[model samples]
Target: MPSPIAINPVSPSHSIFKKMSKSPTNLPASAASYLSAVSQADAHARARSLATTVTPTTTPPLSMSSSVTVFSDDNVLREGEPKMFDNDDGLSYPPIPPTSEQVFTTVHSEFGHCANEEYRFTSQHPPGKPVPHHKELDPPYYILLSTYISYMILICLGHLRDFFGKRLKPSAYTHLLPHNGYAPLNSDFDSFYTRRLKLRIDDCFSTPVTGVPGRTIICYDRETQDYNANLHTTGRRTRGLNISSYNYLGFAQARGGCADAVAEVISRYGVSCCGARLEGGSLDLHQTAERLIAQFVGQEDSIISSMGFATNSTIIPALVGKGCLIISDEFNHASIRFGVRLSGASVRTFKHNSMKSFENLLREVISQGQPKTHRPWKKILVIVEGLYSMEGSIVDLPKVLELKKKYKFFLFVDEAHSIGAMGAHGRGVAEYYGIDPRSIDILMGTFTKSFGAAGGYVAGKKNLMDHIRVRGHSGPYAEAMSPPVLTQVMASMASIMGVAPEPPKSANGTSSNTLIPYPGPAPAHMLPNWFDLPPSLKDGTEGLIRLRRLAFNARYLSRGLKKLGFITYGSDDSPIVPLMLFNPGKMCAFSRMMKQRATPIFTVVVAYPATPLVTSRVRFCLSAAHTKDDVDLILKACDEIGDWLDLKQGVGERWSLQEIMDRAVELVHMDID
Candidate 1:
């Protein structure tokens, strides 16, 4: 393992401190009184000042550096005053109110104490002009002013330090503060998706213990070989894929060809990229992966990045400029919004999946007309996701493409949750609807979910890909996608593209040609063992079929819960089946009870920001991987938990399967229209 890098601590220069100590002009009488009151109220001021003297060898905490000290008037000694208390007695008389000269002198001294060596104070005003009233102040007043001034100076210096340190040389503390505000923060700080995903990390690592009769306790022993725990401890798990991950194909944990490919990468490149892509990055493996993605998606070129978030953030800004306009779906992923903001383009958001709203916005843009400004033609980009992560609803690509043709706007589709889960062969929503992949100016997807690796890729025309390579902000500054992992992603893509086998013949006398192979493993006992390809080549065909079955299972489960007198939201066609539990405290209790019964479930308790205070829910994601039996088991568990709570009945109305399917079809039509 490579040794960890050491970071140098920032130390305040003597000159900087000296400048900070310099006195400021007199504050208003009111402000002075307020400062005095504040000083009197803070009991720890003296102790804090004393604590500053004890400097540790390690870097000081930011809070410690920002802490303010309040000095008493007795601390100041004048040259010719009668000492009310002797120095020998360890007591001193309060010094006289500072004169203008004394104030200036004290300020100058404080300034000197706080400033860096490089900082020099030069007065803008002439020195002989009785230093304006604002220029000199009493010691007590000056002290209060100096504290705030010092704080501002420190903040500026910290920014300067970060700027120079990152732009000039490699530093151990480069991660402390960003050199530019736009630069990506540590991944953990920005993503709500990540927060939701972490809920299941503990489950994956849990182990069943032996010799515990009627009690299956989760083991945390080292011998259990909890891979997730090991990965987290060693910082090997760079990407997140928890309960919220849309592993439509169950590739994440399945012991198949995909896992084999991932293992091969681990054997070759170890775990991490170790450095950003621009510097000693861009390995052959990455290039191969990009090629595979481009071919699979029917795109001329592709550029892989660290994550889907970056792919959107980096690409949008690179394609659209100041004169351009971006027409985005209001419900698009947060990453797309951030990217559009960075583009410096005028943005207009259409109602979520509403074609009419999108057309209206486009018409308005068209009416604005070409200006005689620097850019002659007004450019427009339409942004939407192939599938909404939260809603599990597919985008109406054909309708969107028609609008794109009419408006002459570029179409960017984020296929993060759709790729490998839609289309005739799982090519994504565009292909699922039989829409030419070429119609999508840019299509982005992630490898962390269905592909069982970590990274993202943007597929588009050759020119766009070339432009991004040269001009994309994130390409040069941000770290490149990991190479080793790309190999696994590519391998998985190839496997998904491989010919699917035919489903086994049914035991019934009737023979059906519609049944397709299971694609992967399936139990022999499960009826309708064959997976049927959708009849139409339209976009979301595969997704529609899988979604339909998942929805059916969801509705079946919801109906079961309702039969047991529990309330649940969504119909058969909806991928997300939410069980309404009004109280958060009760929701948590219900979750515990479900776990005790060994039926794992997901819950999203309504809190201030996530949802309105009145509506809390136990959200269930219906995956293609989930068998009918799995859905039935979940329903059984819900009943147990609901009965325990005794408030299961009258929670909410249950949605019908037919009603949900009809609603989904309506939503799809709305997007197209």
Candidate 2:
């Protein structure tokens, strides 16, 4: 059998072990078969590069000997390949070879005074932080089944390799395995890291797409360097329809009224705001944007930060401390979780959207009191998302509010995905449920997704916002939002709140509504039954129609996917929809299959670090600008993927477009008001 390791022309055994450590998957194919497959794939990639090359002159072949070493492709592992998990400081390495892409070492921030300190001081966040409050908050059953299976495969492969490599039994590597079958620490890092390692040369993350993220967009495929091209390779760039990106409300267009406002601001203020908010960055635009945001979200006041992630990450730490406890939904965004961790507060997670589980938690906490202390806790914060981005499910805000009343816990609602895409007036979850927005203690949102802008805000009572302004790290430390980004956000908010885009002047100089086209129009049949205005709503503008349209499309598409046999998650009325695809390989395979199709469907694949390794899925976000035809195209594309992947049931297999249309009509009840 051939050795599984890359032929390093160095110590072969050591090279074998090093390569093994970098395996993307734990599945162990026979060494000979694996090597053969790699050889053929490598040969094919080389042949493609050679075929594309226009060699003006030929060079003599270099001499080959036992001393000659062959490097693998950019994605393939070598003895000392670069990776995010690389622990080596690189100081010990030989002089680095020239490379195409810029490679640089990251210098971690170090404090000088600390190295010379004879002084003693104590911080609230000591290393061995809180003795974790047990599953007092987790679901009835917390399972890491896929992760466990993945680890077991790793162990088996290790043992098999040991046996093959002149070892009588499991070698010292076996000693590294967990004593019990189960690992104590539950982390998705290993799975996520390994997955990323395989995708080092893949364009699944953050592929640039032109136009708003709606029905269709032009996704760019940048020129990729040839596998063996040591420096740069001049490859052709291609563009395809993009169905990815989070421009939920159609505000991310390259040319529009809001875009014009952004351009104007960029010209006037230059690119950046130039400093943090508390320093020299504060502008009249910033103040105006904050005021408008507060008014839009029905808040007493609001504070802005340059990033959504930082807003949550920094604000949570400012709000709570050692004495407080944070009760978050199980599947809350990572930023929220990080902020919770940094706060030094005892955190408990309830089953997502489970009111009963949340109440049970409240009862348990109230009954048991604080851990180790048989005394009452200082403050308890209940955090949940208005609409979960991954699951596409809406939180039962009214019920949660009821519980908040019962438990007297302060409620923090993350409206990151809900603000401009939900509620009757798009005031978010509270408005969706016909409840008062002020009932929410802290209203947090981001402009990146819905507003097609950059930055986020924390809005609530005047006092709360004031405290965040003064105490939040973002206000004093982080750079303020760029002027153009700020203006874009402002214009987006204005448009959503019944303000129409200004009529464009025709060549004749008269205002022409014809030139100023209404950006989004909805399918009449897909509109929801509950879309009727209550007495409180005095008017419904073009903006209301757009929101309703988006809400309907999410439901419409979800129903279609489900009827066709594909497993999906999220509320029917939600814009965020996740189609569950379990196999680790299937995630990349599915994405590639869609992109290579005649009509490419651009999709974002989320696995491992973004979710539990077990819950890998392809998230599809619906936008108001996505026409029914676009949604239909996606449905058919997903159908083809299901067929190729051999997913559960038939899904889109048995039906033609006609059948799909029939089902969609029935499911959405097309004969609606």
Candidate 3:
């Protein structure tokens, strides 16, 4: 077997770069100057020399040494002191020239090359400071007024068009109108929002892409000749910087250890399990994954469901019944609402992420008891998402815990976005806030976000989980989670947890390991015998680095946008950053402009029903795979486009695009309410 190679942050040979090395004397003019700047005496001198001469080499050196130490590439000169370069447009390759001594092991498109350790940060709440609540910073009055006016205009125009089209072209309105005897399938009024407002920007949503949605994505180009009702593929493909996909930990890849494990599982186990868990479809893999999930979340036991939404929708009913009351956050996801409705339980909601409002509502509900009957409720369940999807805000768990102690209500935290994306150990919000995971009554999370796999898990006390396994609708109704997905989950999770060194063998040659602690390494016996992971993943080094990189990217982009004077929402450590574009027209404009940039950038825009009317905005999801240079590019693009769209309505002490890019680290560390 070949020896495992040790990859350094400064190594130059990355998968994205072509294998080419130049002698020191034969280096390009830009590369020569960059090297000269690296060895310069002072910061001012280095800046003066690099301003005009520094540019990334199109063909960088390929370092193959087992042990190589070299100056890191791009904006960062070393670990702490990061310098910005403006000479080259890093469309296809890195902008910084790499020395022959540098060797990077990751694929540039899937996992970016970021060697600067100073950029990394731990996503955790500051001890002394209070938890940050979701505070809405309203845009200028004109911006809000224009947003309302834009929606009004769209509605009026759509109604006018519908009236004229129905009379002039009856065939066009046939589906919306009555046929011979049957009533219209969908009334025109019911879908007014979709037909009029959403239809104009239909092209911006549900874009067809051909590759893994990692750092960059390849999108299929399509055109709609007559309105957005029909779209035709143009047979052209554009590779864009992806800020859209929910691949939070940047695990969505086609060529990693996780992918290899998934491929192996497919060949061994085939695809489907062919039946539900209660039937003959139960596999040993499901039980193994469930156990790992429980350990990962610091719970006693957990139940796995085939789908993320189903994990909430089907399991909630099993936990509560007709007499129970579900006090939920107003901004909870649709799945939570669906589950509550099906559970036959009474529901109440408070202002989103406002603990004071929640407490007041809780007091009223507890005092009032069941509606109409005014009798004591059987049980009260408080539900909230660890990370709200649309707003990019985190739940105030500490306050919720305090309230729980006083009020004695069950707590359920939906960590669909927070798991593997937040915290020092990738244990979700509980770890992020320094709270014990077991403190929360139930911890529900999905593998789709961070594990690069399908399905979801709900963890809690062993008895509760056992009951849910047998009683939940998913047990006998839904198809069992397939083998490939289970393998992907186990592989990715093991990489996060990491494998412990083999236990010491007794004189009789029998293993002598007894037990392991929570949040500790996974035992060898837990994984399948056929599983073989790479050294980096086996030791958990790559997983730790990815978590730090994601933290840096999240803070950098969120602070960068705010510094550039764009009204944004979310915590500084949140992976979801939403830049507000109040006008309804700007939603489509922003998405299109970003996609049509010199180096195409894909974005997700939320409007109308997804968010409040005036809060229509473009949401940018940061990933561990994005390098500092990638963030710089996004900031530069937004600065130029923000001015054109008149979207910089934020009131603050602002900085120029260049200054923000240069002082990214300082900005991320800035203390703000």
Candidate 4:
């Protein structure tokens, strides 16, 4: 036999060691053949049976060096390259290529492996073939399970720490000696008592008089019967004549047509829309309500929402977005302020009805000019209220209109208090001043105040109204305006129309010139001033005639209160009359005293935070519903309360008529009592 063939190693000893260290699963072909030769004949046969039945066409493994030789069962060993082994049959085998497992092991031994050593794969299988080298190939699943188990362990440890960390340690009291030198009590008993005593104790509790504690007319808990009982008491007692509510026109509790309209709404649709508008929540009543509002205000279109607050908060924001400026009156309603804030526009407040201030602000803006590269903030919105809710003063509409024209700003007026109270046909302050309704961009009002309903509407051009209906946050996001409730609005509008007097004709034979008084030096069709007279007779007329009657009623009430020695504040034109009381405690006491005398006077004790402490008062709201008898009864109650308290009139009252009127013209920094 030829001498055993000399076999040269494929690489340097260090390199071979490195490869072997990297992958322990890899074996030299020489070693494998030697093992195969040494195994029992039966074991060899079993191994052959487990091997792939289909013959694989051998291909060389990837390598950077081209000089390396690879050997298989069919290939003869090359001469230049040294082989590792030669079998009895003169066949030789080269070392087996390093497997992935061997490479990983080699790397781990020399340069520590990743913490997850078990995740490394040893072989790459062909498609559809089971992974042959490993017992399980889904190592990621096992890793995830391990991670979850570790997390749970950490969580449980944290919970244990939290539970024990909060526990209180025992103190010297636990070990205190008994008087007889024996154990004082059982250990469990002491522990229980200690735990109970450790609990935090609170001192504050609800007092007997916890609710509103003045007056016999209950503002809340409408079912409470003892009108003279303390409203603040913890018991089911109430006081005061609930007059703070928004029933300005007395339509809420009125008899006849107004009551019937409310009933009709209830009959058509149940209370509440059940869901916001834009869903299946809007009823036909909502449409009718909008129609009635549009007709009443002489607008092209209108959209109704659940509340006046919604009307403001939703509409302004929807109409004005980025690149817009909002010019608001200092005394504008909170709703208007909220709307402007939501609009994301630059806001500037003008002095209350100060045309000069508004002009100056506009001049500054115009002088600064706009940037050339960006779109200028050209869209300007001017917002004001027809009447100030707290001060009972009217906005200077003519001056505001002049500013609107000069700056080309859209005008939005809130008629919460003025609607259904002013104007020739009770159309609102705009109509009262003979302003063409079309000129006002947006008119907003609430049913809760005048119409005695629970909704509000925004009247404007048809396109703007349409945009608001769809884009308004309140209209689409909140509860839809009920349809049945809208029907009631229509009925109310019809009733108002029936009661409205037709305009008297003028000698000029034009319908436009018909009921206008104090027509300025302008055309006959021009709007009138406060004094009801044509240019020829600027002194007085039918308009003044009606105004004088209303003023007479107001002065009559004032005289009655004065005769009873009760000081009253507010102008003759304003229905709101406030009886002054500086002390909050006295306000409650006086209200209770008056109620006990069987006189139910509708009034509210304005207190701190709602009004200045110095201006605390009992506010009485006079209405069209009140008659002479009703006024007399209210005056009598005031006298009785005054006599009971022995209250003497102050020397100089801060709430005098002149002071109130002057303050009304000034910017309202805060709410008036």
**lDDT digits (tens) for residues 155-198 of candidate 1:** 57655755576567756344444655655465423432223322
lDDT of 2 by residue, 576-607 (tens): 87887755666767876776655456688887
Backbone collision count in every prediction?
38, 2, 5, 26
* Stretches > 4 Å off in candidate 1: 1-244, 270-281, 369-377, 499-590, 602-608, 611-616, 639-673
Give the alpha carbon lDDT tens digit for every residue of 464-502 in model 4. Answer: 988887888987688765644554455444434332223
Better of 1 and 3 by TM-score: 3
Best by TM-score: 3
Candidate 3 clashing pairs? 11-102, 11-103, 12-102, 12-103, 56-95
Question: TM-score for all predictions?
Answer: 0.51, 0.65, 0.85, 0.51
Of 2 and 4, which scores higher on TM-score? 2
Off by over 4 Å in 3: 1-102, 274-281, 506-513
- The candidate maximizing lDDT is 3
Order the candidates by lDDT, highest first — what do you get?
3, 2, 1, 4
Candidate lDDT scores, in order, read 0.49, 0.60, 0.79, 0.48
